[model samples]
Target: MTAITAPMAHRTRLRLTARGRRLLTAVAALPAAIALAFAVVSGGAALATIDDGAPAQSFATVTVSAGDTLWSIAEDIAPTADPRDVVDAIVRLNALDGAQISAGQSLAIPAEYAP
Candidate 1:
């Protein structure tokens, strides 16, 4: 005589549907996406607050004369300094779209380099 017994199963397997897998993946990625966005925003704000440690620049107005070109004006204004830098500064301070200047136009000059 022989005894027969049914085999016992130790654990059940889990199978997820395609939709369930996609939903689970999205949920898992949501936290990472939020964290990345937060890092970018905070980094930008921190960068905005960082100072270059340079002093504030001051400006003075100069009226252009009949023979005053940017080069001549910059040279007269800052003889010992670089004329190119002075001219660039003048252009920026006055917000001139081009190098063209009329005789009566007033231009802003950096105070440190002003005559």
Candidate 2:
């Protein structure tokens, strides 16, 4: 009797419609889900730190004037950072490819990129 009722219910059910809405929602949530999963997998095991209400850091923004070289900019941003290391940090910070940079741009000055 159960088998007969199950088959009848399956056959009588109307096919649910509308794939576009569901697909749109899934696509929108993909990036957030990926970020959450990455954070959880990467840092979930970390232990607690002592609570401190210190003011958050305010990062400085340096504008690139005309004819400003990357080396000069990097040096100014990271004075103590090694030149080679600063170059790598600049590339990563400015999101550059092949040491490319244009004038009249702005970039964040990272304190350090540890070895």
Candidate 3:
């Protein structure tokens, strides 16, 4: 013969009050707030020191004239160096968008190619 069992009682759902919900939100946000604070504090120092009085290297500036191109300018400035290499150096040093340069615009030549 099998024994009879009693039915289980229903449990009520846990309801959070306003204060409890605010405390829960604060707890969840605590770590993120602390991380942001640490980042702001620790990032406020100089990672490396460099002497600001004297520059390590200086660049020579060239003024682009009418009818002048990078190839011609590079040839004129650095006669001993290859015009293509000089042009490439000038483009990179001046942060040019392309080989296109306008008249009267100033460009910085790399020290190696500077006259």
Off by over 4 Å in 2: 1-41, 44-59, 113-115
Worst lDDT 10-window in candidate 1: 47-56
Error of 2 at 16 (Å): 32
lDDT of 1 by residue, 1-115 (tens): 8999989978978989999999999999999898779769898554444554223456777899998899999999899999999999988877788789999999888888966
User: All predictions: root-mean-square deviation over Cα?
Assistant: 12.3, 12.3, 9.8
Decoy 1 TM-score against native: 0.51
In candidate 3, residue 79 scores what lDDT?
A: 94
List the global CA lDDT of all models: 0.84, 0.64, 0.83
For 1-115, candidate 2 gives per-residue lDDT tens digits of: 3554434544566564579678878999999998788768867333211243212342345777888777877676666877677777666755677565668787655545322
Ranking of predictions according to TM-score: 3, 1, 2
Q: TM-scores, in order shown?
A: 0.51, 0.45, 0.52
Could you tell me how far off, in angstroms, the CA of residue 21 lies in candidate 1 after the best superposition?
Answer: 20
Best by TM-score: 3
What's the lDDT for residue 108 in model 2?
58
Q: Give one digit per residue, the lDDT tens place, for model 3 in 1-115.
A: 9999999999999999999999999999999898778767877333222234223465778899999999999999999988999998888777788999999999887777777
Residue 7, model 2, lDDT: 47
Q: Which candidate, 2 or 3, has the higher lDDT?
A: 3
